[model samples]
Target: MYLYLQQQIQDVVKEFAKRQFDVDANVVVNQPPRAEMGDMALPLAMELARTLRRAPRQIAEEVAAELKKLEIVERVEIAGAGYVNLYFKRAAYATAFDQRTSGASTGKATGEKIIVEHTNINPNKAAHIGHLRNAALGDTFVRLLRSRGRNVEVQNYIDNTGVQVADVVAGFLNLEKKSAEEVRRLTEDPAVRFDYYCWDLYAKVSRFLAEQADGKAMRSTMLREIEAGGTEAARMAEIVSTAIVRAHLKTMHRLGVEYDLLPRESEILHLRFWDQAFALLKAKGAVYLETAGKNSGCWVMQYKGSETEDETAANEEDTKVIVRSNSTVTYVGKDMAYQLWKFGLLGKDFYYQPFHTYPDGHVVWMSSSERGKPSPAFGNGKIVYNVIDTRQSYLQDIVAAGLRALGYAAQADRSIHFSYEMVALSPRCCEEMGIELSPEEQKRPYIEVSGRKGLGVKADDLIDRLTEEALREVAARHPDKSQETKELIARQIAIGALRYFLLKYTCNAVIAFDFREALSFEGETGPYVQYAVVRARNIFRKLAEEGEGAKPVAISEATLAKFLAPPDGDAFWSLLYLISQRDAAAEQAVVTTEPAAVAKYAFQLAQAFNNFYHRFHILTEQNPERKAFLLWLVRKLEEQLTATLGILGIEAPKAM
Candidate 1:
């Protein structure tokens, strides 16, 4: 409702500028510092003062007079040198709120498709906490886009032919002495989580390669065979990577994250995506073969910021190799091709096959070398957001530079790298999890998790732990509730705790994962907001038992205007204003690509609702009309808070 009023004011002010002053301008709307000042403020008069050679106060008075004609604007006052403060007509605002149901249509449909690629974990082992942060951030952003009426496709890239997967295959073959068939049987066992097995095996391979020089040769041989295909090593790679990919999907599903497609590096190899990308690069002079220096015989592109006094020195010092001396295409080269396909700039397409069917009836497809069945067309996004860690910022830049070098500068410009910092464990969290910390590590603020060292929490393990703790709380509070009911509530709270914890931090900030901080019932946690929802429901439940019906019916605008008039109702009015700004908060979150904005808004709304609850006794009010009005306000608050939680991918349970 606030967004609607803001747009109305902007249109009116923009037209007023063009007609009265003969000047074209952009009108920006902002909130006043205090609610008593005004609901919305426009400082356009000060902006036009110098251009029109007039005093700001005089221009503000003139604009304010014209703006008073708007139906939604109750009055416009000029204040403090040039500010135009606009107040909403109380009855009109109430009518607008009463007319629309919760979760009404948001922004207009944008025809362009947006592809967001995140959770691109290597298909080698179990996903860890770091991967959970990536998925939570990406999934929440997808929800925000859809809420704003965008056509979005979620893609999770798989690096099946990368060194990580090759290392696992080497461990199976050389270290464990397992044949291809034996590995396949192990993957087929329903009781065995193959990814968890590889999690430890991957770490062992890393240690072996570091301690023994001969182990390096085995890894290289396994990588070549996996990429070359038609070998036993390639079959083992397929079995392990395919099983691990399924495990990853299941892990993410527990958190309500889903994807439309999985584009694999193996498919990129079999489908010759790099061959076409390489041809384009060579023809456009985006990359060239180095004949001399340390990079001899390798195809390389000049680094983006490598300019120096001497051209030779610059190229020698900062060239990024696209193709190694052994003729293997680098990860960046393959990523360039993948990015090009996202925007429909690449002249090639991937054959796709259905990879898995989710419980919700959504079919997730995977890229294939040969067409298996009719599938929906993938890629061709007008804009793409790659949610990668900050460590890969340089490689991401190179991918975008490749697009610009090939003359698709417009697509390159639209390519966004939604980079974020890594997630680390808080020192307290390490102690609580029973992981011994070194004396030096204990003094640091946070400890980083490394999958290669087998020193990280598995995503599933953390979820299970949270669920168990939540169940204990629920059982204690609702002792008589059925076992199934308690379990369901526990799962909802656990998921809400995890998703909110991962999303509440800004993208550029490093989060130190701590269970106690996330699951706490008070102060900026998911359970706190969720408890607000449950409390509001209890009010309605009590009213229903007193014969007021199961839900509060809408009160007339005339009654609202009388009750919300002044002094005594000031707190109530303020709470209503906050509830009406949900759309504005969602728009801000979308524009910034930060879920933390919405999460913070949810916490604020929850805080406001709790304060209102304590100040008023709705059910005990003797005046029937005032009671109805308070009930109506509570219903609106509940609706808006629930919608906000939905956008953050958090569920509000019936009880805390």
Candidate 2:
């Protein structure tokens, strides 16, 4: 309705301005700062004042008169220096909301195949709170796209062959000096989280190599053995990386995040996916020998230019060294190859095998040669979204550049780098974690989280704390509730709190995680939103159990169609308005890809419902007609909130 009202006002403004200026008129509409100012306010008077040589207020008065002629305009007034305030019939909001919002923009994306690569953390350690930000944002992003009728292949890239994995191998082989079977037995212990064990082991090897003056050459030896495969290093890496990858999956499952595939780095290399891509780049002249420059020994590609125009904008360095004088490819080269395969430009494919079927009945495909059957088509998506952090912006840009260089412009244009800022600890949390800050670190707004140093909150630790706090609150509210019921409520609230927190910030903004702030149950938190929904549910429960107990209130598909169709004016129209927005939100999130906007809207909608609850009593209303309508409205709000929360990977708790 806001849009239609604005359109009507614009039409009137055009006629009024044409009479005054003898030319076409243009106007813009905006939301009023205060709802009371109007549902929407127009500030066209200032634009006319300059053109007509008249004061803005006088111009506003004339425009207001022109708009008042419409029966839809309940009131039109001039405010401030020149703004034209428009108030539609109160019922018009519900009416327009019902009709216009039924089909809000769900993005231009069709059911086209799209691949989203995210949460590609090395399977080296327990996922920390820092890792949750990446997974949470990526999962919510996928939810938004799928909500818009887009088919998404969510891949969790496993860096099982990276240097981080190698370090864990060094710890198990050279340091602990354990055999493959013995190491497997040690890792399988129930008391120790396999990921947590390797996390410390990786850090241990890293420290020993860097600080132990005698250990420098051992790192090279370990690397060589791992690269050769079939050695102790490779065997140990497989044990550590595979185990930790499963642990990370378990952690993510707790937060309602799951992957459609687990694409391992070793498979990419072993299956010659990179080799095929290298051949393609070479064949296309996208990469060539750098025989004359300082990069003489490298297989180099010319620096591909960016979109912006500026003569000096070309990277001064003529080439990116894909392979140094040595035969081994850099991480950049591996990534370039991966991108090619993902977009199907490399003409190579991974043999897919069923990795695991999740508890939720979702199947996760893994790249493997042990494929005993035919495959579900994967990769070569019309669009690709890689969820990574901003620190890797340069690398991501280079990947896009490589695509363009290789004549994959279409894919480059659509391959989005869904970058987010790192998670750091607030001073309070840092202190609580027993971390000491340097003067330089203290000067910044937050302390940098360090996985190498093991100085950030572990994901499980935060979940435990949140659950405990939630359980305490639940206990207070329902003293007679059984311990099992309390535990269940606590689990829901804890999951909601963490998922909402991970989502409530723009992807570009670094989070300064604070224990005290994250534990809050009141104001701008996930539990607060969950509580509102629970209260709404309780209201309905009360209605069902008591009062004139009118005919049982229920919603149906036919009713929902009418609920969102023309003459949609009602207290419930706004609730239905949000359903259409889920798609638009995903598209906006595609550009911003920030989960915070979705998270913020989820809470804002809940807030609106909560306030609506206070203004009216659904069961107590004497008029049967009004009471019936209110009950339907309440039912819709409850349904919408529950759906919105599901998109955010949050559950609406049955009780607060």
Candidate 3:
């Protein structure tokens, strides 16, 4: 639809300009801020003015006259500063909006495989609000990709054997002095969530270790048992990791976050994937053992010399200890191995085992202990997008280096570090959570969230709070409803609010989360978006009962084409046509790699529906047929708006 319009305008401009320019000049087509401005306005004259050495107004007038002669243009006018405005035929828009016909904006352009890995939280504790942000954003990214017709395999990296897991093990065996059998019994209790219980215990253990002058000795012992990989500490860590990973999964599943695979850090080492990558680095002389320096006796990769302080701080040395003098792999070394595996360059592959599938589009799987049947090309994707935080920039930069150094520079370039800034708690929230900062530190712009210190909101706690609060509102607004229905509505509202707040900002902006702010349904938020859909749903329900007398109005089958009634120049049709462009917004997602584009589109659609609802009465119009048609338009707008919200991992409450 857009291409046809573009071609018509391009040909007209080409003929009118007298000088030849490319017919496809990337014309700027936008909806005029006001209905009077036009259905679609192309500031082509303004754009070409500088190039053509003519004022924008004269060029716009010439182009408008030329464009009026072609199809698709109901009328063409030159506006202020030579803007070429073209009003679309309402009939054309109505026919296009018909749910049966309009197609999505993109269709698997590359047809290349891709893997998106996110929410790889350490499986040793309860997930927190920070993790909620990551999952919501990552899941939305996957939906946008699939909506655009790309084959996306979503994975969740499980850091099962990290220091955090080791710490939890330390808390049980070393601190509590629990025996192996005793620990196993405590772990198996169904009444208690081992992950949530351990979350608090982990913090206690952290504080105890910090107060000791020789805490190093204890941590050293724990690290030894951890690296040994088969001792009780390691086994206990596995038990804890498994329980917590499940907890995280349940939380994500509640919010519609899904994943296709759970790739373990332990498997990277056991599969000897890194050994091959390590060999390649050595043989290529990409990294060398440092015999004498600050990081002496450690292997390193030198950074490219031309870097500023910010870049150099992370890149000054790809030179890091792959194996510490203590013979243990640093996080960087393990990540390099993982990165190599991602590109299928290490000549090692993982086994597939069925992990639990998610309710959304994810078919969760585990890397196998043995060879398993082939699944979708799980890796070696033409592109890899790791939705990680900016704190990992140092390590992520090295992943890029390792790819380039291993002669897979093409993959390295496609490999994206989709990094965002960290989330922090507001001072009031910090106070309420009983986590604090020193006055000296309070001089800063944001508070840092410290999970190890247990100094912020827990993910489950926030959800429970939001759900209860929402239930109260649900009861207030939706009295006489069954308890089950109220709970269902409450869950939908809570999830929508939480997900929208997490996604409202630019990815790189630090969110100083306030409980009051996140929980609010007012203003531009996820629930507000959902509430708009609910209003539209209510409008249609009222309309269906009144207009068709309890009979179905073929509303679901109603297309944008229905608005093409005689004298179809109404602003109502013009605004409803905006609802037909969900695919266009979905396309912007790939270009920006930010899910906020979807969020913005949802709000814009809501504003359109709201304006249409407030101005022209769908229920009280003079003619019954006209009123019914307007009601049909309302439902069409609702369908598309809700679909966009779904693309963002948001749910609409029918009653709000």
Per-residue C-alpha lDDT of model 1 across residues 55-149, encoded as one tens digit per residue: 99999988899888888777888878789998877766876876765435766565799999999999999999999999999999998888777
**Residue pairs in clash, model 1:** none
Which ten-residue region of model 3 has the weakest summed lDDT? 550-559
Query: Over the stretch 48-113, how does candidate 3's per-residue lDDT look in tens digits?
Result: 878778788987787777778766568987788888888776665565456343344554545777
Highest TM-score model number: 1
> Model 3: runs farther than 4 Å from truth?
1-19, 22-26, 55-66, 99-110, 212-221, 306-318, 359-362, 371-377, 441-443, 543-570
Residue 193, model 1: lDDT of 83
Assess candidate 1 and give its lDDT.
Answer: 0.89
TM-score for each candidate, following the candidate numbering: 0.95, 0.85, 0.89
**Which run of 10 residues does model 2 get worst, by summed lDDT?**
562-571
Q: What is every candidate's alpha-carbon RMSD to the true fold?
A: 2.1, 5.2, 3.9
Q: Give every collision pair in model 2.
A: 94-568, 94-569, 95-569, 589-593
Q: What is the C-alpha lDDT of each candidate?
A: 0.89, 0.77, 0.77
Better of 1 and 3 by lDDT: 1
